[model samples]
Target: MKRVIARCLIMVVTLLLISGCNTIRGAGEDIERGGEAIQRSAGG
Candidate 1:
């Protein structure tokens, strides 16, 4: 029983970490696009 609980807890934590990484990656892409737009507008 303890082993089962530990396995479940580890799985949940791994999923959360993966989701967090994806979220951060998406945010970085958005920021990059915004920066590109600003550069284009400024003719830089």
Candidate 2:
């Protein structure tokens, strides 16, 4: 489960990096939103 989550996060980060965040703060927010989505999907 941990590995799966880690992989998902890595994929999200990679995709976001490729997508162009424009700034570190924007990237962080994007990542946080992505994480929240993941948590919600996981029923957290």
Identify the candidate with maximal lDDT. Answer: 2
Write candidate 2's Cα lDDT for 1-44 as tens digits: 99999999999999878678888898899899999999999999
In model 2, the clashing pairs are: none
Q: Give one digit per residue, the lDDT tens place, for model 1 in 1-44.
A: 99999999999999986775588778688779889999999999
RMSD of 1: 9.3
Q: After TM-score superposition, what is the CA distance of residue 4 in candidate 2 from its true location, in Å? A: 31
- The superposed Cα distance between candidate 2 and the true structure at residue 28, in angstroms, equals 0.2
- TM-scores, all candidates, are 0.50, 0.54
Give me the candidate number with maximum TM-score: 2
